[model samples]
Target: MDILYTIGAVLIFAPFIAFLLVVLIARKKMKYQSIGLAADLTTFLLFFSVPVSIKAIWEIDITALVYLIAILIAIVLLVIEWRQTKEIEILRYIRQTWRMYFVLLALAYSSIWAVGIVLSLLHFFRI
Candidate 1:
């Protein structure tokens, strides 16, 4: 149990490693490049990990806030799709929503790391 938690913590803290591992595993099964598939998987992984990472770095849990933002974005996208096409395409909507979440979460993950690095530097310098 402790080992499992340790591994989980490592993966959560180092999502790039997780991403690379996914790509490597996916490549074994795929003849073509697996970057896209790996990215999608990493994005899904980020959806869960980003909030935890943010909490760890900032000492605040924003899981509910993050989820609420995703939902709101999806709802807005759905409305736009409905207005443009005049019909709801479930499959397309789902794909678009997923892509949007990937972009959103990826940006959040990068921003969190950047801010964390800055904070660490400031603390180290006693700034």
Candidate 2:
């Protein structure tokens, strides 16, 4: 159980590394498959990393905040689509919301890492 927990924690915290490893393994099997695998893994990893990244950089737990924001985004998108098309499209709403989360989370993850790296380097140089 302890080993399982350790592995899970590592995967959760080091999503980008895990993503690369998975992509490389998939690539060895099939080039086309790897492309799709990479896309899927990126989104999946972002879901875990977004909250972890936000917490690391901000020193605040944003796990619940991310979910709340996602719900709000879905609501806003549904309203706009309904007003324009005069219909409720569940599938389209899901796709748009998912893609939005992926884009936003990817940006957050990368930016947080960039800021962390910069801060670390600055601190190291100061000493």
Candidate 3:
């Protein structure tokens, strides 16, 4: 059970871990980016599966806070990407690739957090 919990945690955070590795450490290496994206997709699946995996898991209720935050962040990233696309010609090399990866990362993170919140609620209710 402890090992299962540990593995669940890892699955939940895999995207963030991969993103950090690819962005900070790998420095845009194509191979690394591909691996990171794959991990991120897995993270998405794990996130969606949380309720099924944990018998006590329940749906989260968050009004629109998460959506609002995600919209704000997406807008900010879009602006930055737009500026970079205009100013740095070489940015074209990474623009589409980076944008795709960024969107995937954001989605994976948000989904997992939502799932975690639901799981927390389930635990609280002892369901």
Candidate 4:
């Protein structure tokens, strides 16, 4: 059970690691976006599976905390960009460029927490 939680936490945090690697190594826009997309999608599925298997939930788990932190980081990023630009231009640019990734990440990120909560509700469920 603890191993499952640790593995899930690692998967959830893997996107941040991928982001750093892409920035430091690839330095290619496409590569960075690809890594982000792949990580979010993979972690989304990985988190989705464990709860389904255990038929239970773990309360106050690291995976849920990681998801929360991810959401907060995203909110901070958007706020910083908006504050810096002080216009709709950045939004328009994101809409034109990384909109799909942004949308998917948002959905997947939210879903991870929801799943965690529901899985946590079941008695004796150790995710």
User: Per-prediction TM-score, please?
Assistant: 0.86, 0.73, 0.33, 0.30
Model 3 TM-score, 2 decimals: 0.33
Estimate, for each residue in 1-127, the C-alpha lDDT of model 4 and write its tens digit: 9999886666544444444554555445565466555544554454444344323333334556545655666566677777877764665545433444445554655566676667567534754
Lowest lDDT block of 10, candidate 2 = 34-43
Tens digits of per-residue lDDT for model 3, 36-124: 55554554544334333333333454425434554666566667867766654445534544455456546645666687788789889
lDDT for each residue of candidate 2 in 30-108, tens digit (9 for 90 to 100)? 8767755565567777777788877776789988888898788888888898899897778777767777776787777
Candidate 1 local lDDT, residue 105 = 86
Give candidate 3 regions above 4 Å deviation: 1-34, 46-60, 87-127
The ten-residue window of minimal lDDT in model 4 covers 51-60
**By lDDT, is 3 or 4 better?**
3
* TM-score comparison, 1 vs 3, better candidate: 1
Model 2, position 114, has a per-residue lDDT of 88
By lDDT, highest first, what's the ranking? 1, 2, 3, 4
Candidate 4: C-alpha lDDT: 0.53
- Per lDDT, the best of the predicted structures is 1
Per-residue alpha-carbon lDDT of candidate 1 for residues 6-102, written as tens digits (9 for 90 to 100) = 9888877777787888788888888455776767777777877899988888789898998899899999999999999999999889878887888
